[model samples]
Target: MNPKISDSIPQEDKDFDKQHIWHPYSSMSKPLPCYHVKSASGVRLYLDSGQSLIDGMSSWWCAIHGYNHQELNDALVKQVNLMSHVMFGGITHDPAIQLCRHLVELTNPKLECVFLCDSGSVSVEVALKQAIQYWDSKRQPEKKKFLSIKRGYHGDTFGAMFVSDPENSMHSIYTSYGPDNIFAEAPQIGFDDEWNEADIEDFKRKIEKHHKIIAAVILEPILQGAGGMRMYNPQYLKRVRELCDKYDVLLVLDEIATGFGRTGKLFAQEHANICPDIMCVGKAITGGYLTLAAVISTRSVANVISGGRTGCFMHGPTFMGNPAACAVSVKNLEILRTGAWKSQVDTIEKILLKKFKPLMESGHRKIRQIRVLGAVGVIEMKNPIDVALYQRRFVELGVWVRPFGKLLYIMPPYIISEDDLNHLVYSLISVATDESLA
Candidate 1:
């Protein structure tokens, strides 16, 4: 039998949650089955039913160091003892300062200014505001629209929602509610596929036609997450930078999913050897220990907005720069800087390539494509599989993976053992090989 709720949580609370608490992309009236996790350690999730499953999603690709990390734990504890939070409007703290400094230094040298926010979506909001304000400062308020690619996923907030690929994303219904931002075709070529100039022609034409009204060109860099686990070549980004420069438009790269070595680099823009005018990073920033995101910008963009009539950026979250989050994030950055993530991601990539090769080669009739980048491995099916059924199967098989749309993917924690990764691959293969579940 499954255990009751945690000692701290009443059984009634669990019952209430089932009836009222809506999960991501879930309907409140017809909720999907929910699993109860008691605790997590390293790369495994311990469930209330006394089952242990290797985590394949990394809690949506944030916990790079894995769960229950001693360093991250100690950092959070120490900060809580000092203070949990303080209003960032008038006050400042060393934890936030240190975290921002590390972020600026670790990113391209040109990205010097930082705005710490509560989540990835909020950081994107702040970036959008900064871009708009920068143009407003120059009296070019007409430069209000954004240009982005199809099959791109930024975030769910209003401004972020506007830039994401509407039809492919969950926010399609809200498209009518959000701004009608320009959309270009996603690169036709795959990440490993040879580049073709024709793939970017439509994007170029869109930008050239819309440059006057386009404030910024925002994208997920090389890897587009959520909308689909689509990975494209860096030359697309290279061309974006050149075009943005030519049109005097700001470039914003949303690295919320790809930052901090998730894409075989500390930042995905490094693959193109370019620096965006503004960048939004979150998810792994605090090692998934806390809700924290940052909008990093070049000093030029910062000065332009601040020097304008407003005299300051107009957005602030209540929990902006929570000391606990920053303190833990500082420690997380220290751990990431130790340089284990790079080699670890490389290993994960190799294992994924080796393990998934069979499915890619032999399962072509059922599989659409197989993609691997850094720690991310995805098997795209010709049609969407049964989500609840597949999830239950993975749980029973001692692995945890969340499938969405036609993609069954894993973005495992960096600290995952090679053996654990192999098991995850094995579980996925088992399902792909079983047509009954399809």
Candidate 2:
């Protein structure tokens, strides 16, 4: 057992949380019941109620190695004994250097430069700035707009929001407050569907028409999260890369959700065998241990931005390269490099396909579609679901599965055992088959 940080918060503290704390787009006035977790280990969450539930969300798809991992804990402890955080403005540390080197080696060769940020959104914001500054350096300041697909999700920050699928994105209400970036229709073909020329043509025309004003073409690549758990063909990615090169527009792939073997590759862009000018990665970077994201770019983009009108990147978070986070991230990459994560994800995909087959063949009218990729399994419903209701039901069934809009999905920790995974499947089936849930 780990040493205690402090005495545990009593029930009164939770009541106060209900009264005051805002929980991620939830209504405080009619707040949903917040489950108080006491501790977590492996793939299970131990609640204050003394009950443990299998974690199916992976803490929103970040905790790849699961909770309370000894290796990650040791890494953090060692880094804490040395130092935690230091300013990255003019100073650097071994943790930061080693982490950056690991990231560069993991990605495409041209993507050699890394800009560490505090979160996924900030990394994307940095990517946007890099693309814009790259164009500004090339003497085309008006090439400032970003073009993205209709169902893509980058992040919630203003710049990231501008490049996301505004209409379907949760930040849609703030559309009037942010820049109106262009949106091309999402590819019609599924990941497993036949390659369609029409899909490429639709996106090609949009890029060709707006190439002059578009500084970059940003996409989630392969899998789209948040907006929808949508998957598309890698061929589209290849074509998009070609179009970007043809128009001299930079390509920015936001792999915050798809990176780090989540989509059966260390980077989802690898599926297409093409490289982006800038790539944003986060989530599993630290094995869900700490907050750390990065914006990796090619040497050309870095050089152009350095010599640009701005004369610098013009952005740096105070905790840009937190040593503790970098140290944990390096350890996380080391764990992944063992090649076990690939086999684990492949096993997850196969199991999800087998377990979800009944639902796929159920012929239920309420079911819209079902899809699985890598470790992600999604059940899209025809009608919008009551998030609070479904979440409560999942918890009652001894699992944690957060349903958003019409999508009920699970991206469990890669270390999950078959028995635990089957239990998660049982909970999902219970939610889907229950007429009362509708």
| Residues 1-438, model 1: lDDT tens digits | 333223455679777987888899887887766778889999999877677889999999998889999999999999999999899999999999999989988999999999999999999999999999999998999999999999988887888888988888888899888689999999863887888888899999999999999999999989999888889999989999999999899999999999999989899999889999999999999999999999999999999999998999899899999999999999999998889999999999999999988777776677888899999999988898888878878877888899999989999999999999999999988877677786
Cα distance off (Å), candidate 1, residue 229: 0.5
Overall local distance difference test of candidate 2: 0.90
The backbone clash count of each candidate, in order, is 0, 0
User: Clashing pairs in model 2?
Assistant: none
Model 2 Cα lDDT, one tens digit per residue, 284-402: 99999999999999999999999987789989999999999999999999999999999999999999999989778875777888889999999888999999788888877889999
**Model 1 lDDT-worst window of ten:** 1-10
True-vs-predicted CA distance for residue 230, candidate 2, Å: 0.1
Clashes of 2: 0
